[model samples]
Target chain A: QKEVEQDPGPLSVPEGAIVSLNCTYSNSAFQYFMWYRQYSRKGPELLMYTYSSGNKEDGRFTAQVDKSSKYISLFIRDSQPSDSATYLCAMKFNYGQNFVFGPGTRLSVLP
Target chain B: DAGVTQSPTHLIKTRGQQVTLRCSPKSGHDTVSWYQQALGQGPQFIFQYYEEEERQRGNFPDRFSGHQFPNYSSELNVNALLLGDSALYLCASSEYGIHTDTQYFGPGTRLTVL
Candidate 1:
């Protein structure tokens, strides 16, 4: 099984709606969880970052991690057309080390 | 400040041909990491360079090699490339010794092996 698993979602939602993107990992050693946003033909941008199991809020994006379940999630509130992109979850055991990335979920917030 | 910069934004090569991609890390950053992203997939870590040496490597084959110059710039060279070698190559930079350092990525070089 892949170290990280995420649904390849082409999930479509209306503007102003709440969207939840999630990922699960098989490696319990992963301690740092991160969410990245990538637009078409662009590099991935860091959206949210969390260490261990906890919740972190930044602007309209909230990242939640449950170490016990080896799950992580990114919640986008008041989604906008600009939010349409691929959401990727990544995790690492040590700083500046190799990070495992999920397949990513494609999201489109339609107007 | 300029983020990580990759050269040859796009490239096309034939099977069995070799390819070299270049990257200059962000200002004040001393570490560089390379990743390969296939179509519709997340970037896969290839290797990382710090202090002019490879500190970590992923599951890639020996055909994939890299070099880090004294200036902290890096190069990823693939020999005997196959069709599967075609992918978007990304370069990320971060400051060594910074515990919470997040990697800043470049626009990436798109490689197409024919």
Candidate 2:
């Protein structure tokens, strides 16, 4: 199985809609789960990170990690065109330096 | 506070050539990690450096190497590059010894290998 898996979505959503992005991993040992957003011609910007299970919310973004299911999610509320970009899920083992990234999901938010 | 910065925003090279990309990490951060992102793909881990030493590396070949300086800056060197090396090379910075320190990324250098 792939270490990390995400739907390479070209998901389209209208303005003010709720957008949900998710990823699953085969490795149960991953402790740090991160969500990154990348615009065209730009490097990834870290959106949110979760240490273990449960949910974390910041502004319009909310991240959830369920270690038991090896699943993680990012929810964007009231999405705007600016929120359109490639969303990537990355995770790493405890005390490990490298991150294993899943194939990003491309999102397009329409005005 | 300045964020992580990388130089030569774009580069072009041919097969079998060598390229060196530089990075200045975010201030107060001592660890630097490199990643390669091809078109339509997520960034792939290249390696990490701390204390001017290589701490961890990914599955890339030996032709891909890196060096860290005392000032917490770094360089990624690709020897005998292949067409597949065409991608955006990113440098990320984080503090050492912090289990949960977030990595701040630079804008990245785009390399096109023909």
Candidate 3:
């Protein structure tokens, strides 16, 4: 099985809608979970970062990690057209080592 | 200060050829790591360089090699590249080592193997 699994979603939603992106991992050793946003032809940018099993909120984005189930999620409230991009979930052990990445979910927020 | 910067924003090369991509880490940063991102896929770790020495490597073969200069600049060299080597090469810089450091990424160089 892949270390990290994420649905490659081209999920489309109207502006102002709430968006939920999720990823699951098989490795329980992963302690640092991160969400990255990537636009077309661009490099992935750090969006949200969380350690262990907890929730971290940054402005309109919230990252939740559940170590018990090895599940992670990124919730975007009040989505905007500019929010359209690929959302990737990455995870690593304590000090970042071989960060495994998910396939990324493609999201499009229409105006 | 400038963020991570990559040179040759885009390039096209034929199979069996060699290519070198460059990256300059963010100002005052020390560690540099490289990743390969294919179309519609997330970036995969290639390797990392710290203190001008190879620190960690991914599943990639020996054909994929890198070097870190004294100034914290880096170069990723692919020898005898294959068509599968076509991907976006990314460079991420961090202030400290990979452990417990937040990585800042460059714009990345898009490579096309023809």
Weakest lDDT window of 10 consecutive positions for candidate 2 chain B: B95-104
Model 2 CA deviation exceeding 4 Å by range: none
Model 1: lDDT to the true structure: 0.94
| Candidate 3 docking classification | medium
The two-chain DockQ for each candidate, comma-separated, is: 0.78, 0.73, 0.70
**Model 2, A20-107: lDDT tens per residue?**
9999999898999999999998988999989999999999999999999999999999999999999999998865468889989999
Q: After superposition, how far is residue A22 of candidate 3 from its true place, in Å?
A: 0.1
Please give, for residues B1-114, the per-residue lDDT of candidate 3 as tens digits: 999999999999999999999999999899899999999988999999989999999999999999999999999999898999999999999866445687888999999999
Residue A69, model 3, lDDT: 95
Q: How accurate locally is residue B21 in candidate 1, as Cα lDDT from 0 to 100?
A: 99
Ranking by lDDT: 2, 1, 3
Candidate 2 lDDT at B54 equals 92
As for candidate 2, its clashing pairs are: none
User: How big is the positional error of residue B50 in model 2, measured in Å on the Cα after superposition?
Assistant: 0.3
Off by over 4 Å in 1: none
